[model samples]
Target: MKKLILVRHAKSSWEHQVTDHERPLNERGFQDANLVSNNLNLDGLKPDLILCSDSVRTITTASIFTSNLNIDESKVIFKPELYDFTGGNLVNAIKNCDDTVGSIMLFGHNHAITSFVNTYGHIYIDNVPTCGVVVIGFLINKWKDLNKGKTIKTVFPRDLRSSIHSR
Candidate 1:
């Protein structure tokens, strides 16, 4: 079984006049990233590889999850191609991954993330919000063989907020 975890980068700040690629995460982004990552139940499944977009917002979001999960920084690969919002490059990047990897965690932008999940996963999601996580499981062994798979779990900051605050 192969597991793929898709995480949308945290909410980005528009206050800066920097280019889109250089936009940093907003304050809410940091909080949401921490909340969602801390709430995930990995069930002993850890990512063998982490593919992250080279953009600043994506990197910051991925870094928070990595820190919370105790994932080694060495496992991460910042790919410029993953910055795509179209999902085409995202699909290609995933399909081209080494066959040796059983699980992969990808940090990217949407509608690519949302579109990919709805297309590949069994469940249909309206949107994958910032700092949202969707875990998908495929029956195939090789990355190239990835097909329609199960939507195992979804962790969104909005959902967590209510539950956390209630408790």
Candidate 2:
């Protein structure tokens, strides 16, 4: 099974007088990113490759999680095309990944992230919150064989909280 992990960039700061691409993560975003990493750690889900948007916020969010998780930074690849808001672009970008990668983590903006998850998954998640992480499992052995309704896991920050509460 191929695992595709989708991570939405953490909340950005509007206080900075810069373009959307240059905006950095806010304090709340930092905390939320840490929460996301912690949840992933508890879930024992690790990715072999991390494909992230070149935007500052997305980059920062990826960095925070990888650092906290003690994941090697060299595994990450920053791509400008991931900044796209449409699901088609995101799908194309994912389909282009090296097939050797068994598990991949993608960090980017939404509605692209949301649309991509909803398109491929059957779950009815209303919104993918900032720093949210969703894990989708594909049945095919190769990335080229990816298709809709192949997801096996859909994890989110709130789901983690709820699971912890129930436990």
Candidate 3:
């Protein structure tokens, strides 16, 4: 069996006049990630490995959760391919994942993360908001042979009552 945890990069800052990949998470993004991490820890959601996007925002988002979990640094991999916003790109990263690992948490851009869960998971998610956590389980032993299995759960930042209402 395999478990895939998909997390969309947290809300990033546009205040910085930098490239998209260089953008960092905003203040709320950090708070959201911390809140979601605390919840995930309470839920006992731990992964054998984590595949993270090498971009600034994605990496920072992943770090927050991993730090809370105290996941070994060796278990986290920053892949350049995950920096994309295409489902195919995310799937490619999954396909290349080490078969020995039973569960993996992937942090990346949305549309891709949202589309991936919608495409492979049994449930329908209209959108995977920033810092959203979507868990899906596959019955297959090998990650490469993974297909539609089941939708385990989705933990949205707002669902945790951490939504930031606009003024």
Candidate 4:
């Protein structure tokens, strides 16, 4: 079985005048990233490989997962195509995954990410908010044979934040 996890980059800063690719993560982005990363770690779901967009926000978000999940730097791959706004490019990336890897994670943008999850995942999600995560599992042994799979899990920062009981 092959497992694929999709993560939408955390909220980015519009305060800067830089291009979209250079825009960095805002304070909320950092907190959200940390929250999601911690949640994934607590769930004990580790990725064999993580594919991330080279954009600043996405990279920063993926880095948080790397740190919190203890994923080695070598396992993280920065793909320029993931910067794409459509899911087709993202699907191509998944199709190219090495079969040796059992589980993979992708940190990217939407509506592509949202489309991919809803298009292929057995579940329909209205939206994948910033720093949201969706896990889909395919029964195939090879990445090339990837087809619509089961939506195993979904995690969102607001859900976690709301679940907290303050002192």
Q: Looking at candidate 4, what is the lDDT of residue 136?
A: 94
Over the full model, what C-alpha lDDT does candidate 4 score relative to the true structure?
Answer: 0.92
Per-model lDDT = 0.96, 0.84, 0.88, 0.92
Ranking by lDDT: 1, 4, 3, 2
Poorest lDDT segment (10 consecutive residues) of candidate 4: 37-46
Instruction: Choose 1 or 4, whichever is better by lDDT.
Output: 1
lDDT of prediction 1: 0.96
Q: Kindly list the per-residue Cα lDDT of model 2 for residues 125-158, writing each as its tens digit.
A: 7778888877788877777778875556555666
**TM-score for each prediction?**
0.98, 0.89, 0.93, 0.96
Best by lDDT: 1
TM-score (C-alpha, index-matched) for candidate 2 = 0.89
Q: Which residues of candidate 3, in runs, are more than 4 Å off?
A: 41-45, 162-167
Candidate 3: how many backbone clashes?
Answer: 0
Using TM-score as the measure, which candidate wins?
1
The order of the candidates by TM-score, greatest first, is 1, 4, 3, 2
Residue 59, candidate 2: C-alpha displacement in angstroms = 0.4
lDDT of 4 by residue, 52-156 (tens): 999999999999988988889899999999998888999999999999999999999999999999988999999999999999999999999989999999999
